[model samples]
Target: MMAEKEVQLPILRSVYQDLTRSEQRIADYITSHADEIMDKTIPELARNTKSAEITISRFCKKLGFSGLQGLKIALAAELSSSGDDRFQDIHRGDSYEQVAGKIFGNIAEGMQDTLKILDYAAVERAINALVQARRVAVYGFGNSATVCRDIETRFLRFGMVVQAYDDISQQLTSASLLTAEDVVIAVSHSGSTMNLLKTVEVAKKSGAKIIVITSYAQSNLAKIGDIVLTGMGREVHYRSESVASRLIHMAITDVLYTGIAMQQPEQYQENIGKMRSVISATRE
Candidate 1:
């Protein structure tokens, strides 16, 4: 449950088992001497680790760094911190109060980091795409599908045409019908979901602009996206059970929703009033 900002060591550890032998060696050397790694050039580190410079660069990208310098800068920042105690992972014997504090602290930290790294320009671009599109189709599976449904509900309130699909068959059918005037918001934390990728491919063929929300900047999903918004957070040990990612996803969705609302305030207000009146009548 470490804060996303202090991600250098945690990211390496999180994906260590998936790294190649050479990458593992590089990761080991860097983690052990993180402070010094910043001072050394990529070639120098390559020599030290007996890895080629290209290998070092590839390893950095695998961890979502732009290059060696980016990796070094992140490492330096993480190593300088004494580590936030509240963000520590939960223990077996922790009290309920301790668990609550840790969970809240971790979520807060992740949101802060996500905000810090968010590309406002890209967000604006995404908003523009959504606003200009003839239709907006949201695609996601599992927990991400819940996020997609939330987005659909928000856009629907604005009187916009939006559809969210949780089933792969329905997603493919919806995607196949999209055109260049449409926009697709594909939500996948890992960005490697094959089913989502397949749907995206079909959508792309019809010239739909893709907006991907994921944690990995260099993931396959990002590669295909017209605008890629990165969600900052490391999935804890019980990744499937973690709420941190869902929180981050909702935060990003909030930004987009507000952006669209602000762009057309008069229409948004009118739609909101109508929706409220209709819902209130149901309650009565």
Candidate 2:
């Protein structure tokens, strides 16, 4: 299947809270009147939003566009793209089967969207960092903590020295100790979690590589990321705060794990065999 064209509306939505007052005003106008954006020139947009042309241009650049024209092009592409919203809301008195189908369908579409936006080069950089790092640390809180633990579980099988931290203090402490030879995988769905951002900032100052797995490519955490893996999972009415994004993040973890294994097949195989034997013995 062909990948969908890159969409910018979601990026605006994700970063809306982080934008400055003037930028937010521009975003509000563009997002609310997306269909009319193409027909208007830069001056018209600026005048309509009650902002200067330069402010609008700056806003576009902040969202990773070159200028207003680039933003318009992206808006046009998104407007013309063909796709229906797959995430259905869970209404009261809905049948069990109907609810099940809706949930499953949304998750499937979310994954598909992730695959479409998944940057292979970024994935390769992350895998290389993980493989070569003297130590690896993962940071996540709330829903993202599960993905962090999954990272630890998968990398440990490959005999990699990795730890996952869910607590803010622990995350900060771990970040402070990381060296140039270390890597940090920071997971966040919103990508704007203040505590996680602070921890990642510490990790950044320690000269360790930061690999951010988040849905927002332009988030503050992503700005600090040496390698950014973007996932596209929209917040639906039923699944508030990106509950669906956790699964998408976990899928990314699996991709990284498989890639790391491929880099050294025989060594990974040997480690897997040893780990499986010891764990099997413990289970029974």
Candidate 3:
């Protein structure tokens, strides 16, 4: 039996299972052009196979990929020598909009990678612990600080007492002060921020709940975390915000927030009102 993490191509699930004629045709085309399809556009592939765009999309989803684009991208990676680019050419001749869209695409891919490596049972345990924690502390450095602030702001609506630490001294101080009943969510893309990890260590020995969100495996942060959520990337380009890594972190945060909300309905509603009250007052 294949593990969930090992299951990449959904299309290979069953040879005898039902498939629409159009889907079968599209799948055949993918198998034929498995080499060139990696960089092919949706319109181009559809045209080549005489298949409609929607049919191709459904075929991809039927195979377990989120869309046709994802399936092709994966297949392309398989054919390419390295399937990894240390640098991106998309920035060379692109407009700002083009750059922005490409960045978003990267983030989406990064998030998907993170999801693939994540342990759902850990997320569940973290969510339960957080919901019952006496307080929550969030810490980060650089762009990660923004992610920390964002998650903290959302967590506050549940009326959970939340704090964000940006300064090392302050974070350390707070970490030392936290009790076993408190939860700390630390954010770092590289997962190697010395200050953040130090703070996490302090929190750890103190018995505080530790959730580590980062982009590296075998990372020290991952080693200490009670829960490690990854943000993945490829070569050719270092993990840049304009591409996949940022979106991956953004997705993980959103998923955690959504889980918290769904796990505690009354608390979620109360948190919603806290945001609404500010808008209501602004209108007044």
Each prediction's TM-score versus the true structure: 0.84, 0.82, 0.65
lDDT of 3 by residue, 120-151 (tens): 78778878888889999999988888888888
Off by over 4 Å in 1: 1-28, 57-86, 238-243
Q: Is candidate 1 or candidate 3 better by lDDT?
A: 1
- Leading candidate by lDDT: 2
Per-residue alpha-carbon lDDT of candidate 1 for residues 1-284, written as tens digits (9 for 90 to 100)? 44233234555643565688999999888766665676798889999999999999999899878998888777766656536443467777889897777677777767766765677899999999999999999999888888899999999988889999999999999999999999999998778899999999999998999999876666788889999887655445533422577778888999999999999999999999998999999999
Report the candidate with higher lDDT, 2 versus 3.
Answer: 2
Clashing pairs in 2: none
Give candidate 2 regions above 4 Å deviation. 1-8, 115-120, 277-284
- Clashing residue pairs in candidate 1 (N, C-alpha, C atoms within 3 angstroms): none
Models sorted by lDDT, best on top: 2, 1, 3
Candidate 2 positional error at 39, Å: 2.9
Reference-based lDDT, residue 123, model 2: 97
Model 2, 146-220: lDDT tens digits are: 899989988888888899999999999999999999999999988889999999999999999999999887788
Could you arrange the candidates by TM-score from highest to lowest? 1, 2, 3
lDDT of 3 at 263: 87
Global Cα RMSD, each model: 4.1, 4.6, 13.3
